[model samples]
Target: MTATHRTYPLDESVDAVIIGTGAGGSPLLWRLAQAGLHVVALEAGRAWSDPSADFATDEVAQSKLYWLDERLSGGDQPTAFGANNSGIGVGGSTLHYGAYVPRADPRDLRLHSLQGVAVDWPLDYADLTRYYQEVETFLGVSGPSPYPWDPARSYPLPPIALNTAAHIMRRGCDTLGIKTSPAPIAALSQPYLATGSEHRHPCVHRGYCHQGCRNGAKASMDVTYLPAAVAAGAEIRPQSFVTGIERDPQGRITAVLYDRNGITERQRCNAVFLCAGAIETPRQLLLWQAADSTLPLNDAVGRNFMAHVSTQVWATFPQPTYLYRGFPSTLITEDLMRPDDADFAGGYLIQSYGILPIMWAEQVARSRPLLGQSLVDYLMQYPHVSGLGINGETLPNADNRVTLSSEKDARGLPKPHITLTLGENEERIHLHADPTLRAILTAAGGADLWISRRTAHTIGTCRMGTHAKNSVVGPYGRSWDIPNLYIADNSVFPTSLAANPALTIMALALRTADHFLQQR
Candidate 1:
């Protein structure tokens, strides 16, 4: 369905006021509005009015899709925030996300119950199993049928064809007796009509998934849920940044205060869904808490932050690997998802990776001291380089939190000060992954290895759990302090599941919306 561009009165109380129309907010808005509730989504940035026409494949040009707002960072490893993690605009980070939509393993959700480390999620995989299928179907996720994982299911769309790099990775995995499968991604492998006549075409494999898909195939929320929500009678107010939430004396949220075109307006609502993402979600809460001295202290609001151990091991192969020609994650292996010999408490996933020219060069320059002819010659070998990446689970650290920074932004709102450091489990996983990835590539006739340390998919700042005292929100995403408020984004993830977070966030968001509807 195309956008109806619905509008709602500011002072008139609506059924729900959703902040940020990304993966979380968009899905819920579509659901609530389709169910005949008055819903409005307030986005901090402009909507991709026509994504196919507006989106460009150029990496720097597509930077507008990212949330580049000022965010203070400090820790043993200060986290990278912008395009690598969060996005603004109507689609949120889904705009520039790599679109690798892996489902969380049952072990990913119940890590605490299985290994006695990291708190288990309030709801386990069983609770989210159906939602996973729903999200996959809605996104038209392309993957191998009979997914080779626990609690497996067939995909709605066929797997995207593997590129040269994936072939080499598969060869190595095959020789090493390790299982490999085509990675699941939200990008369509075939033409699909997800909602109404919104026809999504198959991916052309331009391999610019990180730079935002110029075609209407990646299933970014802008191309799917946001417009569907608008068509379903939801009001999408772009450039409206929510700064404060108002509540009654009984601790029930009543209205949302936001700035749209420099004018502050109070949007009265019976309930609010905060889906601004990991950094902004907690930042909004902390900012609200800072202004109100009477509000009870909730140290748990920004505690236990986590970023997956995103380490990429790149190798130059004798044969052309064509790293720039396919989806970044074309192939995956769960062989190490639960390794018995690992010192780390949890496991990690290995994926055959792709990289564009500029980002690859940046990594090369950051990792090595090659200069002049040496640098040019090494860079010239780009087509022969293949990469294997690790998306490892991270145990939460209370000290790894998002605190209010003294710095203020253009809107004078307190910036989110994100402090995150790798714990022992993550460190050990990195150590294991580095050698393992090197071995896999080497077995496939690769050499000149370089490993880049990184993190992606920020999560768990406003974690969901069984109780409010120890967690930021309840299992259904309702806040314990504010009865009518819910957090339906990555911020509500209890742990950083050892996979990309977009699919799970969508699943959790749908579940939260379903629960909200069930209660109504």
Candidate 2:
């Protein structure tokens, strides 16, 4: 179904107001609307109504889809290319994500109990098993059946076809005695017949998944949940920038203020959900606190910012691998994700990945002093390049955080200052994983290899926990101070799991929506 782009009056009231129609808000919006609640979803960016026409396979042109807002970066390992990792449109970052949908290991939930490092999640994997299955089914995820990790259920569709790059990685893994499996992804391997009016075709293997799927095969929120929400009578307002939230004397959130085009508007709502992502959610909360001094600000609101510690190893093979033909990631190994006697508290996931020429050039520029002919020479042999990377679990450090910067954006709100430093544990994990990746590429008959350290996924800004002092939200995503306010995003994660965060974020959103429905 085509989403209804409706404009409501400034003073209009609804049962729920959701900020940012991304992976987090979109699912909750659909659930609430299906539960008979009037919901309004506010998006900060423009909606891509016609992705086939609007999106381009050209890497330089596709860079416009990223979130390029001013965000200052600091620390020993600052995220120099922050915008490249996130998106700015209606579907949020999911618009540009590779659609990897690996589930977090059950051990990930009990970090504090088992490893004695970070705080444990209020609920375990058992609490989200049903919701994970529900979200996977709704998104039509494709994966190998009888997963070795013991997932609660099987995937709805068959696994995506592995490319030559994945085949090379699998051979290397076999030689090294490492366990390998087909990577689970949200992109459809077959045509998905929607329950509503929306329909999604099979992936064309265009190798442009990160530029927003032009064929509607990717399960981005715009094509899936957002449209379904609108079909269920939910209103989605694009380019609506939420500034601050208001609460009554009883400490119940009553309204949300936002900027639409050039006008400031206020919308009254019975409940408010903040899903503006890790950086923006805390920034908005800080703005709210600045406006209302009486509101209690959680000290941990933006304290523990965590992004995955990623290091890529690009290898050039003798033959043309055509690595960019299919999905970017097709094979994965979690053998090193958790070792019984590892020095590090957490682990990492190594997977086969393919990069476009422009993206490869940009990554090279960011990491080293290569430029001009040096980079051009590397790009000259694009067809022979095959890549793999380790998405290592990062521990939440109190010092690595997002704070309100003195500089402001066009909307007169303070820009978010992000500081990310690789902890000792992460460094150790990377040191081990980097060599392992190098060895795999070597075994795959790779001649030249390039390694670069980078940041991948973001999490743990508004962490949820059992206590009020250490966490921003409770187990159900309810704010500790404001009863009617909820946070449904990766920001509420207490621990950074060694997996892509999209699936977990969706499951958590569905669980939070169910909790809200029960309360109502």
Each prediction's whole-model lDDT (CA)? 0.86, 0.86
lDDT of 1 by residue, 129-158 (tens): 899888888888999989888535899999
Whole-model alpha-carbon lDDT for candidate 1? 0.86
- Candidate 2: RMSD to truth: 1.6
Overall local distance difference test of candidate 2: 0.86
Candidate 2 residue 385 C-alpha distance from true site, Å: 1.2
- Candidate 2 regions off by >4 Å? 3-8, 80-83, 194-197
Candidate 2, residue 447: the lDDT equals 71
| Model 1 TM | 0.97
Clashing pairs in 1: none
